[model samples]
Target chain A: MNIEIRKASEKEVPFLVRTIIDAEKSGTSILPYEKIFGLSEDETENILNSILKQNEEDCELSMDAFLVAFHDNKPIGAVSAWIEALNDVSSSVIKGNLLRQHLSMKNLINASKYWQNLQEVHFDIPVKSIQIGLVYVAEEARGNRLAEKLIKQQLEVLQKKINQKEEKVFVQVYHNNLSAIKAYNRIGFEIIETKENLDKNLLGVLPDTKKVLMQLINIKNE
Target chain B: MNKTEVISQLTPIFQIVFNNPEIQISENLTANDVKGWNSLTHMILMSNIEESFKIKFSLREINKMQNVGDLISLIESKK
Candidate 1:
């Protein structure tokens, strides 16, 4: 396969939206995007498209923040990562503000009503650190280091934008996603923090509330 | 309501959401001025503001808010 990776453009919003939703679900049927806002797949897709249409590096939601991996000129998998503090604003602030702006009033009301369950799984990434927000690979492309390639390529892309000393890279994933954790482990990432929801009701809203933060330790500059 | 009335009402909402009673709702105040004004709190604050003012902010309106003054203007426009 002729593998190629590059930053996604605006025209690829549909693919990136699907990729993001899939990454959020993590091989499950429950989509947090829908559950959080009480929106359907179509509604989530539409709002996500509007959010990703922006060219700026607004963390994970920005179109330019995602790197697409294509096998033989066909996009197969993708990953989204960015520096935490862009424009001196926190990543969470950027993302949350964007969501607040784009989501419909009814959806935001739903989110407000059940903010408790959502907050249970919410955590902030460190400032000035490299944050990996979403990752998804096609089933046919499994076990091929495709995820590692996409991530490494994204890191390299973000490396030039960093002016800090000793950059720390972080990726948050559900604790139940053993395969993804194992994949990250192979790429020299280890669990540095874990957050679990003590509220059992959150289970109905999301598949799992236990999230693990993985940090890259042996990242090499080749 | 006037800007003064809006500011007076918003102070309590900001205080409650940010958990910073000392936060003064100045026109130039931004998320940078408050310590706990991250994404989660921002959303919560928006929800609380909508509930207190009984207004639904449009997407464009929310994006236009840059500082406390902008927020006050948006609220006044909605009213």
Candidate 2:
């Protein structure tokens, strides 16, 4: 199969959002995007499309962080990555007036609190590093190393944009997601720390599961 | 269960857990050999295996298993 990996365009927002939601569905059901945002699937898709559309127009904030993998001109997988600092920018965009219009005050507060708790539990990422989030390969496209390729492509793009001092790339996987953890390890990421017993009520909402933070150091050249 | 019978039973577990009906299992088959045998699915596979075999694998045993052969051998020993 001819697999091509490229940055996503604004027109692909719906596809990207659907891919993300579908990917997350295979994993944990708790703390899902729908539950966290307190919005229906359609509403969540609309909000995501808005974010991608606005970011495409302004080009500020790493809003263009999605990378898509296409096989024979059909999208098969996607990975989202950006500089760690962009977290705040993206967060602000989510809390901005546009999203607030669709999201209730209670849902907004819940989402904000959950994110804040997540930050506290995950610890701080190093300065000048990129964080890869929300990686998903289509069910039909698994075991073909698409995830690794997407990550490598994202790292290559991010490495070029960042200064030489920034050499670390990190990703968080749930402790139970051993296959993802193994895949990351195979890709040169090592488990640095694990936050055990995450307050089920506060953030993860999954009892008895922990979040493990892994990082691939000195990836600028690789 | 003997090794052969264990493997016979284990094959379908893998097929069901990975959601690939055509999955063929060999002694050397690792996670790399099958599609959708990711970390998340691996845990699910283990759970299903335990349920089917009516045996529990220790954390160490789970971590030590490097291939399907090792899993079958572990199940044999447990039995």
Candidate 3:
């Protein structure tokens, strides 16, 4: 497929931001930040860029956690993975702190209105698991298995940073994202957990009420 | 505001943010020690604290915060 995947650099901030926005959308048009936090798409992009450019490996949101795939010198796909609980701080705490720093008081206040509802569908990736997220491939670059290549290459990089012998690798996805589910299944990930919330209030705040956690153990064991 | 005053004020914020009226704010309290203290509500909690204290936390300050003691200390210093 002529796809070359490498650790993303600061120069790829724009691409990484797009990949994150797309991945967070989960193949849907609903961008949670905009709907839940009252952030404009541009505002969300700027915040994402701020978080990404900082190069903090605190969570999946950090740019240092992502691997970019390039075909013909243009980025086509990207994926982020991180070992949770570095130095005793959970990725959620680090990520929350990061967002608290960048998000405006106004946005945060607006988020407070919807934040409680987010809890209804909130899914936490355990502290020790290797969480793989923000998996995205450019539309033009699809159908070539670029996502699969990016994820495998990303695992190779993450396996070194993670110290433990056997760490459960996880990816959370909307159950309706059949394409993503199919892709993860191809890579030996199985659905280990599923949470469904049928509340009608989540119509705009979340893309889907049903979410699933996919797990992979020992890439080589496949 | 003194630590006592901060703790007194902070107690309600924590309880309301976590939606647990039974919570008693203590120095040793960490995110793991509190139920419903996950990433989804953390920012809302921070912003609420800012409004209550009328202070903004820098990225470094937010990142360095470890527990309730650190939070009260930071808020006290900021106030």
- Kindly provide the TM-score of model 3 when superposed on the true structure, using C-alpha atoms: 0.90
Candidate 1 per-residue C-alpha lDDT over A26-112 given as tens digits, one digit per residue, 9 for 90 to 100 = 878889778878888998898888888855455688788899988887778989998976555556656777888766668766766
lDDT of 2 by residue, A64-123 (tens): 778899998888888887774332222222223334444554665455435433434444
- Evaluate residue A139 in candidate 3 and report its C-alpha lDDT on the 0 to 100 scale: 90
For all predicted structures, in order, the TM-scores are: 0.82, 0.61, 0.90
* Residue ranges of candidate 2 with Cα displaced over 4 Å: A23-26, A56-63, A86-102, A109-120, A163-166, A198-209, A218-222, B1-79
Model 1 lDDT, full chain set: 0.79
Best candidate (score: TM-score): 3
DockQ for each candidate? 0.33, 0.01, 0.54
Which pairs clash in the backbone of model 1? none
Against the true structure, whose lDDT is highest? 3
Ranking by lDDT: 3, 1, 2
Model 1 TM-score relative to the real fold: 0.82
Q: Candidate 3: what lDDT?
A: 0.81
In terms of DockQ, the best-performing candidate is 3
Steric clash pairs (candidate 2):
A178-B39, A179-B38, A179-B39
lDDT of 3 at A181: 92
Which run of 10 residues does model 1 chain A get worst, by summed lDDT? A113-122
